[model samples]
Target: MTEDSSQAEHVAGTEHASVADRAAGGKAARAQTPLNSHRGWSPAEDRPDPVALLEEQNLTRVPDLVPVRHGRMMASPFTFYRGGAKIMATDLKDTPRAGLIVQLCGDAHLSNFGVFASPERNLLFDLNDFDETLPGPFEYDVLRMTASFTIAARNNGFSSSDIREVTLEAVRSYREAMIQFSGMRTLDIWYARMSEQELLAAMDMARANQKGKAARKASKALEKNALKNAAKARSRDSMQALAKLAEFVDGHYRIISQPPIVIPVRELAETFGLTAEETEAAVRDQLKAYRQTLQDDRRRLLERFDVVDVAHKVVGVGSVGNRAFIVLLQGRDEQDPLFLQVKEATASVLEDHLPKSIFEQPGERVVQGQRMMQAASDIFLGWTRGMQADRYLYWRQLRDMKGSVVVEAMVPMGMTFYAHACGWTLARAHARSGDPIAIAAYLGGSDKFDRAVTDFAHRYADQNDADYQAFLDAVRTGRLVARGGV
Candidate 1:
């Protein structure tokens, strides 16, 4: 039997069990996998080479842009970790699980959590990236998140104690929040979400509680910066994209050419020996297929716009070499513009070590996972198969008031605060699709799980440093080519 089927059978009847029975089941889980056993990490004797794993992934990416991915990852160990989800997934599979499951973010590093405009036009803080999402042990996501804080904190030159404290805050907040969720009604848990205003107010309260003048001053500065970024995000819409990326040429608006990073479709069509008209027709066909995946209302809304232009756009550090394109559409008139991003969706990295996803198409797996995890998702979210065989793609607005914290500039206190927020948000997301009571009960009412995971984070950070050095060595010896300043 498949791993997913086996695991599903393990928890099959627990959902309908009494609360007391569920709690007992959680307690019983400790016998099979003790919480303290989660501490420490050691590469197995047969562990795969991390650099080789990255090179394997590059084999599937656009050859010209693979170096860009390498260069981006070579920026720092933290950046490498961001793109090393496959490496971590390999390592995590050897670790103990609580036998509990959740729809995982799969790559739940610190940067993946961010604020985006929900369907209701409200700014909501949630998991913003789902390219590698899948169902797996709940701890896998938590470990990935906590380890991210450790790597990021170290990159910022945080002291050992400060790093430990920050990492602990993330896991602790998750534990405490899960306990709270365990008591909430199903509907309340579903409705729970962190809004921008609520986040800002929380920051304000935290700043006010700082004890010293310098501390409070620093806190206030971070708060102000966050507020400024939120306001900036609000202005980052289709109008902004049109102003920055589109221009009038030959009497019509077309996407401006910025080769390697943003190449117009006409340029790409020539590379493949296809005419511009033929290329645009293929793009339109993909859009029509994607529209069918959307709700009736969304499909109607989409039909009002006409495709104007398309371009190849490289996006995100980890997703650099994947097939990604920006589609320009005009509604009513030239002034009404909408930009939709169509990105290639590959199988989740976790699928290598865990159960294969039930969804056959990778694009549908991503779309369904995002819809299940987020409290509210982008209105334009959908999926489609590309013209080429084995190419699956998902579509969403290019921008909708999206913003993320700049981890490089964060201080210890700022990181701790951010960690707490991430931990709480992750717990809420897991609560939605997993059994909060059983998972929370398994965690218990102590810092034991937090401390154990923190220990694992420290060890994993060391391993990441070693792997990063190996990657740099590969680039130096001509085993890998990296183009910087792209």
Candidate 2:
């Protein structure tokens, strides 16, 4: 075995007991890794260059859109941190860890958690992104999440004391929630979820604890804002997508071109030097293959919709350069439509340091990981390979009541409450994939892990800030090109 592989195995053996050992519960788990020792942060004397690591990731992404990725990462330190998951993965290799393994949301920053409609049409909050999901030390997700809160708070002009409090509260919530999950039955833990009513109730509780008039007013405003955002998300269904992205062209509905973000089917075909006949044929074959990945019922549901147009669209801060295509389909009439996003799935950032997944296709890794971690998933979720069989891709509804908390406009109370929600959501996700009994035991009923995580988050945010400056320097010196207005 390689040196890193051997070390990982050793760490795993020494830090966490096997499933049989885990039956001994918290006491046995604590004997393996103490909670207090998790405190402190120390950077390794030798570390990889952040810029080099980022440039390496760029190699796998689309060449033309790479500049746009750079530009988005350059927007702010927090934004840079979003795309710098690879850098942290490298740094985390040398950090102190308990070695308790779980299916990690490798990039489990604050914004990655959100509210989305479950198959039952109930809006539930959970870890919504799994592109970088992998099995690794559980604390890695906690570190990523806490640091994100700090980085975002700093961006929003939060005081140092406030940042620390928010981070602490987030960590505490996770610890307490894990304890709650530890005592529950397996089915209970699996069924546990945070719903819209529960979320608003949390906000109301926060609002009640306010001391000053201004604080109370801000709390009320945040609650009102959240309600408005939820309503807006509910309206962002396939019909809305059709209205915004499709137009009645030559008596048939076709995607509207809004270059360089959204490019229509004909435009993309010409750009690829393919005739309309070739492009349509290629799409049909890919769609047929994708249908096979879904369940029989969902496949039949997809058959009812006739694909009218396809477009290449830019999406997300970190996923800017990745190949993400939106397929527009009509059911019976132009008014009834469904939008499916067929996104290219690359090797996860965590794959380098973690065990390789058994699945042959990267899309399978993402789709399976998501289904395992989510409380409920999309009925149409599935995967397929590219025409050349060189690429993996997954398909899902474009946006069915998907929304995230707006961090930019948040007050201190709002931020703290949101942080708690994210922590609870993450803990529930971890409990589904990891041994909650042992994890809760390892954490214990103390603030040691909480304080340690807070410390690590602060230090990592400092490192991330410095790295963001270096990235800006690279762009300024033409070492990296960052396209403006992308």
Candidate 3:
């Protein structure tokens, strides 16, 4: 709660400090805004209710699916963290920040960092979700990740000391990686990426000094699991999607519907209070406008496919209540099918708290931000406005070999390696979008900042756990409704 000169300068006015101001005064900025000073956490007495915040967010989402969203969040504390980005953002709005701006993953939890196919058909490990992407204080993403690791490790029954170590490793990796990036050439920083082999090597090195039989055994199992997951991710392409979600019914490809998760367009129309005829026509028009957003080659390539089916598909925890549709397009024959997800992109949760996006459309904001922060993006990535409803939707392949960590299943050794990977990826992402030099200077060559953030993570994770318990009580008392659990 104590403010330094820089903090006082920032808090005294409504106007934000200029990037130029910080660029010329990295060390001064560090002096003015010491990380060690902002290590503790205490929620304000006026802190808004978490359930109320969630209900406010649910106002813009699909009414029928909001219960499911609550259900997913009720599953675990880490799951709550995934869906509680808006809540945390609101809380952190009044907290002290270092004033170093960057494009935040906004919901930078451990599960959000994953392996996906690069355009060149190679597996790349990076931050994969951008639903809440926006320009904000770099610490927002760091805090989100650190707290996520702490909560996730705690869920797996790790001891408090072990959890602290995991959180420290993550923060340490991020600081060290940012420092490395600061000394690299601009192009080299841009080109720097974590490959599959590099990830395995990192795991190997982290566990190299372990001499215990149980430790070695756990390390080998962890490596094998990671490799297997990566391979599984690589196989989850359009064809795999077709096999899982579609079927050859009466000599034609049709998306199989499993209600509450996948409902065909005809059924989805009723939820919108629209007739089937009106729904199909509206979707057709949306696709036409969507083509214009694509590049010439991609647009031409899309022209070869004929839209056969569209269905409402429920996805991730935070996105459960939002409008998400998957379109099945047949190319050449039934053998060549492309599944494109048309997901609704609303105003980012960070929009009100951070610098507003230059792009007018929310979908465009997401697309542009993803392109800017990601080392490589989806080939078919684009955005379009809705025809039937007032919505902004981004279009991309539903599954481009996307694979994420199941935190509950991870052992201590796997958690450590995964935490480091997440930290390294987040640092690279920040370096790509913001001034790495200023950030690196602020972090310095010591573990002071890392330790400070580790302390913050522990306190925030405690907050998150308390919130999770409150949510369960709310559900039990009929104050809030949750449908099912995992």
Model 3 over residues 1-486: C-alpha lDDT tens digits?
Answer: 122223222222223445555344566667777879658878888999998888889999888898899899988898888899888988777666777777778888898889899988888999888988877788888988998899999898999889988999899999999988877877898888898889888778756877898898888888888889999999999999999999798999899989889999977788777798988888888888888888899899988998888999999999998889999999999999999999999888887676666678989888877887788889889999976467899999999999988888887778888888888899999898777777888888889988998888888888998889888898999988889852
RMSD of each: 1.8, 3.3, 4.2
Score every model by TM-score: 0.97, 0.94, 0.93
Residue 428, candidate 3: C-alpha displacement in angstroms: 0.4
Best by lDDT: 1
Best by TM-score: 1
Q: For candidate 2, write residues 10-93 as lDDT tens digits.
A: 323344555546646556556666676555676677878899998998887778899999988987899999999999988887
TM-score of 2: 0.94
- The per-prediction tally of clashing pairs is 0, 0, 0
Give the range of the ten consecutive residues with the poorest summed lDDT in model 1.
1-10
lDDT (CA) per prediction: 0.91, 0.84, 0.84
By TM-score, is 1 or 3 better? Answer: 1
